[model samples]
Target: MSETGRLAVRKTYKLFVGGAFPRSESGRSYVVSSSKGDFLANAARASRKDARDAVVAARKAFPGWSGATPYNRGQILYRVAEMMEGRRAQFVAEVVDADGVSARKAGELVDAAVDRLVWYAGWSDKIGAIQGAANPVAGPYFNLSTAEPTGVVAVVAPPFGPLLGLVSVVAPVIVTGNTCVVVASERAPLPSITLAEVLATSDLPGGVVNILTGHTGELAPWLAGHMDVNGIDLTGCDPDLARTCEQEAAENLKRVLRPAKTDWLADPGLDRMTTFLETKTVWHPVGI
Candidate 1:
């Protein structure tokens, strides 16, 4: 067929769960628009039920993913960067439409997102070395402690810098073998689903990172209070919402990273990765 005769494929933005794109079980979608209020596309408005389903998928995926070697996980993350490179144009366009930034600025954001993935990938295999230590116990035993993943995490991605911020939050969580359910920027969620496409095809296992598009206020409470979730990052919530989520999270003693003034462009320290990690110590007889 001639090029002109072919059709341009249309994408229906849907919730990314279990490595597959599924519309919200509630069968509802909201109109996504540009910063100037121009219509862009319709996106699935995920419900609390969807949040639970994502958590289930994340919990199911945790064992295998956490069991994999850090080097293997790093390689998979590098693969995600490669995939993002291939879809640069789409991501840049989405960022432009979502944030009303110039093409060049969007391009820079896309580049940073790719680089951020690579940066976290490099840390994957080295985290243990930097964070683990040998205890100086006064006994004939070798006492060693190392960082381990904190199981399934719930994240509220920053409302700004949809692509870079989303990548910043999600990459670190998964790089250390923790699976996550993220609520993307409610104002500019288009780039998130596009990112999910990159993850789905980049050899990443299903359910390692599930993204939901909708109101953070509607979803944060349920994710925070869920008994099965091990941590919640309130990076996107306002003070009031963060307080509510924190209270809910306290019910299960979920490890919570409180909302902070974050400069997305600044050097992201080790906190994001370390925040979702727990230390495991082992003791062995010195001579045995």
Candidate 2:
């Protein structure tokens, strides 16, 4: 076919919720452009209603996901890594176009993201063991504490280093059984939406990870104050926005993870996962 005769298929980036791709309820979309000022595609401009719907999906999927065995969750997460590996070239291209990075750097970022997911997958069954503890009591009672899922979590993915930053925040949240509503990078959302495609087909249960592409300023407040939402991660927000969201989260006593300047490529350790988990201590008579 002649170059002029060939038709290009343009993708309409939509929100991924409940394992399905849907347009914004408001029927709104915004133009996304390449770093070189060329038009890329139109991404769904998520609204407050979209945020509410994503929270509902996350809440509905919470029980099954949280109740699932840690080993099962780990396997599912590993499957995501496998799928991502298969789509490495696609993600690398998206990262390059979105961030204006060189192909080599983009490939490195994609590889790091895949590796990050695998790292979190290994932590699934071990986190509880590491975070939980047994205590010695003075009386004839047995006491032990264990970590538990904190229910639905809302994550604001970082604006820069889209793929690596996104994986860094999200892998830790869902690895421990907490379903999440993620706000993709506003300026560079293609990689995140593409990752959503990987999640949809990777044996991950629906609603376990909902990704929305839009302005964080429009959606963060609603998620912060959402009563059903158990936690919020502001790792992608600016200091002022993060502070505002933190205040809103206090309305329902939600666990708020404030934004911090960190190296996404550094070892994350247990802090990210532990921040969203709750501790439960049980005591019973030893002679029962």
In candidate 2, stretches whose alpha carbon ends up further than 4 angstroms from where it belongs are 1-5
Q: lDDT score, residue 48, model 2?
A: 93
TM-scores for all predictions: 0.96, 0.97
lDDT of 1 by residue, 175-251 (tens): 99999999999989999999999999998999999999998899999999999999999999999999999999999
State the lDDT of candidate 2 residue by residue for 34-75, as single tens digits. Answer: 999898999999999999999999999999999999999999
For model 1, the superposed segments whose C-alpha errors exceed 4 Å read: 1-9
Q: What is the lDDT of residue 116 in candidate 1?
A: 94
Q: How close is candidate 1 to the true structure, as a TM-score?
A: 0.96
